[model samples]
Target chain A: MPTCVGVGSPPVMAQPNNYMKPVGSDTRFGAVTRVRGRIDGDGNLVVEGAVEGNISLRGDLQLAVGSEVTADIEAQDVDIEGTLDGDVSASGQVHLGPGSRVRGALRASAIIIDDGARFAGRLECDFDMPAELEERRR
Target chain B: MASTVIGVGITIEGEITTEEDVVVHGTLRGKLETKEHVSVEQGAVVEADVTSNTLMLAGTLTGNVASGERVDLQSSAKLVGNVRTARITIADGAQFKGNVEMDV
Candidate 1:
């Protein structure tokens, strides 16, 4: 028999190169090729191409260099190393590396950005401390 | 298998939420939420609210962080915001400014 976990049990993190799949379909937004839709998966998403929709995943989302995305992205964590033209939201953390460029807003619990990285947008943070609250009383 | 890797020289602007771990070596703007770990490697730049079980920053982050386990700011890390988590670690060369609430 399989063990039962909590409803909101955290998912297991996969390798860094097994998230997103290539855009199998086509779109009219542009001829440059883009993905338009909600993405929910358990693997890594390596977007070497372009996406014109929102990406919602249960794992990590990585935008390779030279790649562009014109939609919102939601996942457990986010690692941007390419070009994004939208908003990003994560329950875990967000990372921005050098030479990376972004134009939009971001919301998450933790955020990390390297030097030489260009970004323009708003930021929102939400940190939960249930154990901390209990410790304060002691 | 739902983990995405944003290679170097890449840039993204939007919202990213997942249930697994994520690593960034580029630039990103927007929101990032996860149930696992989020690693912002060196040379990475991110501006958003990152939530996850654990967060490790070796790059630059400007925003808030809600970590269930802990938040580690490496020597090459820089962050500015209100961080709330069970534990927090700031390296000697790490730069951070904001309200920090630990489990203590």
Candidate 2:
């Protein structure tokens, strides 16, 4: 909101610009929220609380540490730094940050497990055909 | 800004329990419980029973409401459900179709 210093018209008239700001695309769940159900979003999401349901996003999904989620997740990208007890599927990359503990099935195009990350259950990572591998076959 | 923000273009269908304040600019269709203030902003839609310390509504809601402290319905709001609160205020231009209980 530091942009409150607008072009001398006050913020009331800048409603259109306000709606087009970068904050319009990101959803954040603060440290006190506990949700149970299905979340459908077309943009990125940041979770710092607890959720017991399903999350499906067309963009990135980040679960901060101290957050615990017990549901299934589907997204374009995923970054986890918390505890998750459900399945996860991402069309893009998936990263498990430090201190993340997961116990469920995970599938993504690429997966990265950082140090201090703990994961249990199934993992399915699909890698595209590389030129070197294809050349060796020829 | 409120602690938990449900940005516009997002839709949630489930129960939400929070210990801090919540501001909704999107759509929520389920139960919502909070220990702190809960605000439904303009153009937002909520179809859930709400329990909170304070309630501020500026959108459309179709469910019962229970506030521990007070509840305020803004002028642009459209509410249709029962409301139970110790103190309540309804602004002009707001539409409400529900019973209010003060218990006093």
Candidate 3:
């Protein structure tokens, strides 16, 4: 009778494959002049001075404490930590931090208001769906 | 990288237009426009029309949204209005009502 080989031996452990990649870090910064003109940029912006005109950026816009802006702001993201005296428009979200003050109207799809923040103005939502508003009128 | 943060104690009331990312931990009222993404944290209150590529709501919003990509309503979010985008997700416990249209 031929002897059969035992099949109870442990199988070889294969190397574990790791396909997860590390997360990338990005750090960008931009500067704007405190004058009476249009301020536009493609990178992140930090306003630590005064702006007396329109501000347009392709990235995030941050208003530092004690900073003041007297114009409309347009950006992908906006974070106000100081004072704004103009209209604010963003394709993204608008954040209002504590102790922050804003005195103008805002238009965005998303918004946040922290405690102790002061804001006074009109608000409009679902701007992208103008047709809905018209339908309601019917 | 190019990120905007609205610190606490800062207040603004006007129209804002941007093409970058934004985060708000404060208070704001007015119109906001952007081409990227916007995030509203808890304790933040906004009354405006928000437009962006993507939007995440974690606060109180009384307005409409026009997101080119998607709109996410977190568990702590309270929104009332119409939302137009390619995709929409409302987390549990999030308050939202109105019309929603997705891109086909």
Kept native contacts, fraction for each prediction: 0.00, 0.79, 0.03
CA lDDT, candidate 3, residue A51: 65
* lDDT for each residue of candidate 1 in B11-77, tens digit (9 for 90 to 100): 5566665566677766667777778888898988889888889999999999999999999999999
Give per-residue CA lDDT, model 1, range A1-138, as digits (tens).
221111222234344452253332111111122444444444445675567777766656777677788878887677777789999898777777676799998887766776767889987766555776769988
What is model 2's C-alpha RMSD?
Answer: 9.5
Expressed between 0 and 1, the share of native interface contacts present in candidate 3 is 0.03
- Candidate 3 lDDT at A93 equals 65
Q: How large is the interface RMSD of candidate 1?
A: 12.4
- Model 1, TM vs. native: 0.47
Using TM-score as the measure, which candidate wins?
Answer: 2
Give DockQ per model, in order.
Answer: 0.02, 0.57, 0.03
* Candidate 3 per-residue C-alpha lDDT over A1-138 given as tens digits, one digit per residue, 9 for 90 to 100: 221111222223222222341112111211222334555544445686566777776666778777777889888777788899998888766777786899998877666776777899966445343676779988
Residue pairs with colliding backbones in model 2 are none
Q: Which parts of model 3 have CA positions greater than 4 angstroms off?
A: A1-50, A53-138
